[model samples]
Target: MSNKKKERKLAKKLLHKYRLVILNEDTFEERFAIKLTRLNVFVLTSISAILLIILTTLLIAFTPLREYIPGYASTSLKRKANELNTKTDSLQKAMLMNERYLASIKSVLTGEVKTEDFNRDSILKAARQDIDFSQVLPNRQDSLLREKVDKEDKYNLFEDNNTANFVLFPPVNGAISEAYNLEEKHYAVDIVVPVDTPVKATADGTVIFAEWTMETGYVMIIEHSQELISVYKHNASLTKTQGDLVKAGEVIAMAGNSGQFSTGPHLHFELWSKGYPVNPTNFIDFE
Candidate 1:
């Protein structure tokens, strides 16, 4: 056999051994090859899909994505919030009272009102006649009588009599901002002092009043012999109480800006004998 023919036959045998074949027919033939098992592919695809779903769920549940969900408010939490609000409101009111008391003190010291005629009730009545409740009381006779007696007694004790011997310092060392007068209806002397200064008793007396007031803040009223009464107003705090005996120059209170009519730290000192307002400066030597 010829060498070329032998080589051609050997090549054809090698192609047949490897299952490589060429068709001579003119018709097309369909061919298919399997790469993987159907069951295996399906199982892997299902597992991947499940893992994606789980990851997405975890992100939504544990991350900021959860914020999209509306959270329900608890009644207990709401109640607590309301209570806090109420407390805050009360504190604010107290602060406002302190501010006003201080302002009133400043006004008195600056001569806004006459010390001799400064009547807190009368001023309130005149300025707020529309809101006056004095006339609406069930039994105003007692109130009127008491007021009248108080005024008369104060006037007589300070003006008509000279019974008390103990002199007093009108206020702690501070400028006399306001003086006593009767024409303008101012009935007290105002002394401007630093906040928290000590307020001393003008004379030996028993404390008749020591309490927080809307207009005067913390007030201390002392009654001495011969119907003499001294009023200390707008105290930040009181060291003495009602019925407590206090001596002249004794520390009775700490100066404060507490009251509804005060503007700053000061002592609104008033002297009364019998029942009327008296000039505190007359008895106190500021120099």
Candidate 2:
């Protein structure tokens, strides 16, 4: 037979009708009946399978249940994991540095090392190291990259190119107990939040400083751009460190009465433009 004829024959066989009937078991009478075909059944099953697959895919891709799947993690989850790992590594380094400092203190207390009349020549010789004075020539690719970076950095907050339109996140949710007073040398505003309240970043930036000082206590400062900097002072503890990038509204510290100047728990938030302090209340509304 010809190919066309063969296909027609097979199609006819598939289209063959079948009877699906429910017979009364006691009386042998047909209680119900429906007409069905092989082709019809096959098509129905295929469509049902396709619908099931579509629903399953949508559920996994669009819902939080996707996290339950092995080897699958959302973009935000991955980023958080990386941030935590970086924090862990930084803490390890800090611990090692602290250990070295403690060891030096112990040595001084025990007289294991001489405090004075040390050998200046030995110190100078130990400090001496070989220097690589080879000049590095800039390639075409490097020059192009440098130019691109410089061009992008030119329109920063310092130049007032775009920051005036940017909205800032409130560092804390509280009442402003103290306003910015430049005449009184009070450059920052004091927000009165309950103790242990989180202090958040006002913009996306890298932490430039996170340390304890006698005046500020546990202070954290973030550098947003060439001209913009946000400082959170009198914190109980800092969650970020120098060089760590933080997003707007991300918690960077906890509010507390840490410094000698602080009488109660609060967040002393300061915004700096260029070398001068700006009124944070102008951009952020604590109330």
Candidate 3:
């Protein structure tokens, strides 16, 4: 054979040793082969597996997929969640108590109960009467019983109607910022107005309290008939003093920002009836 043919044969033999076939030697057929070592295949497969695992771990840890994993949240977040649940439970309990009280009142009005024993004091009194402490201690002293009676009397006095009616000194003019909410410690409605705006009473009442407070600032309270009371706070100045009888629509004070808690010049007004605060918005017309 010629030198060229011999060299071609040697090259074809080397290619075959490396798992590569010489194609189209006599026919138009193509051949294919691979020369991968066992170590190379194993390394490639291991790297692919590691990459897949890392990607999966990242997806589960940093994405929303982590929600499927149980107990993944931090302890502080869980504690806050528990606290919110407890508050919700307490609110639900209070709502149920209010509902029951309203139902009891309705039943009494419909002649369900022998008498209207729905008031808080009356209910407590009835409960005390039904209790038999003598059974627990037959030799209970009479002095202790007398002391209990005195305590009950004092409680009754404390529960007496301390409510008063209130009058609007300034009829209308301003915007209300905050509102009265006993739960939030904001026990009055905050009315925002220009400095030195006129403050009026909603009804005729006698001023029971007129002073300055750290929270309320330049406060005034008036007591009226039917145990209704009105409070005006955060005033620039007081036009009246304690025991001063003021009529409705009378200017009792000027609106001002005198206290540290006040954000601007405004009056914080509150209304109480029978020692219980009621929503002032229900009675006053805002203008």
Candidate 4:
């Protein structure tokens, strides 16, 4: 027979219906009867297999049961494991440093090391023993040049405007809650004001730092011309970001008590000149 005739005969055989009957042999009565075909059985089997595969895939992808599968790990679990390892490494380093510090302290306590047993003159003489004393003194021209350089540097930072005499704008209009005290090491002035009161900048400058700290809360540092800087701390919120240029008397923050050291709503203001913390009270009046 031809190929087409063979295929047609195969299809007819597969589609040919057969009656399925169930009956009790002794009763001689049929309980059920149904018509079925080879093609129908094949299609039903294929559909069942597809549904089973879909169900298995869903269970493996979404449920924790997937962890039971071999060679499978969640991404989140790996990230957490990495974080734990990093913390452990940091803790190990800290412990090693502490152990070294303890050893040094023990050495000092046992008289194996002396922290303050040497004289200044003897130390200086021992350090200078390798050098000739004649070269220590410069010629007349060199001394003159050295003096000229020192003179120029003496008035470098405060040449145009002495920070000591520079007029500062008040950061906030409020009563002084805490006065500046050198003994207490409180270099900043604390001014009390109503909550949400605007805090102004003391001078025109670019913001060097602006962020929240555990101790100072919302703190901001501004760098002005001539080595002058202003700090505003314990603010409710900051209006400007780091590297922003701010003008004098501009509202930069709001008075608040948002830090660990704060007792009530206030603005903690500080001024610094040439890396030295200056009392804000010296420049601005809070009363």
lDDT of each: 0.75, 0.80, 0.71, 0.80
Q: Per-residue lDDT of 1-287 in model 1, one digit per residue for the tens?
A: 69999998775654442323454457645354334444456677999999999999999777766656679455566899999999999999999997886675454433354335467898877878666678766477888998887876652334444644446655587887777767766688788899999999888899877888787798888888777778888899999988799888899999989988997888888877665567877567654
Clashes of 1: 35
Poorest lDDT segment (10 consecutive residues) of candidate 3: 107-116
Question: Which tens-of-lDDT digit does each residue in 121-177 have in candidate 3?
Answer: 888888779997677554458778878878756423123344222234444466778
Off by over 4 Å in 1: 1-165
Tens digit per residue, CA lDDT, model 2, 1-287? 69999999898889888999999999999999999999899999999999999999999999999999999868999899999999999999999998986575333222243325789987877655343325556789999999997887654344555665566889898888889986676778899989899889998999877888786689887878655878788999988997899999999998899978887999888877764667887667798
Pairwise TM-score winner, candidates 1 and 3? 1
What does candidate 4's lDDT look like per residue over 1-287, in tens digits? 69999999999999999999999899979999999999998999999999999999999899998988899987888999999999999999999998985574333222242234669998889878978878788999999999998976653335564455555789888888888775676767888998889998888899877888787788887888887878888889999999899999999898799888888999888776765666776556677
TM-score of each: 0.44, 0.45, 0.41, 0.45
Q: Give the higher-lDDT candidate: 2 or 3.
A: 2
lDDT, model 3, position 147: 83
Better of 1 and 2 by lDDT: 2
* Per-model root-mean-square deviation over C-alphas: 17.3, 20.2, 17.2, 12.3
Ranking by lDDT: 2, 4, 1, 3
Backbone Cα, N, C clashes tallied per candidate: 35, 0, 16, 0
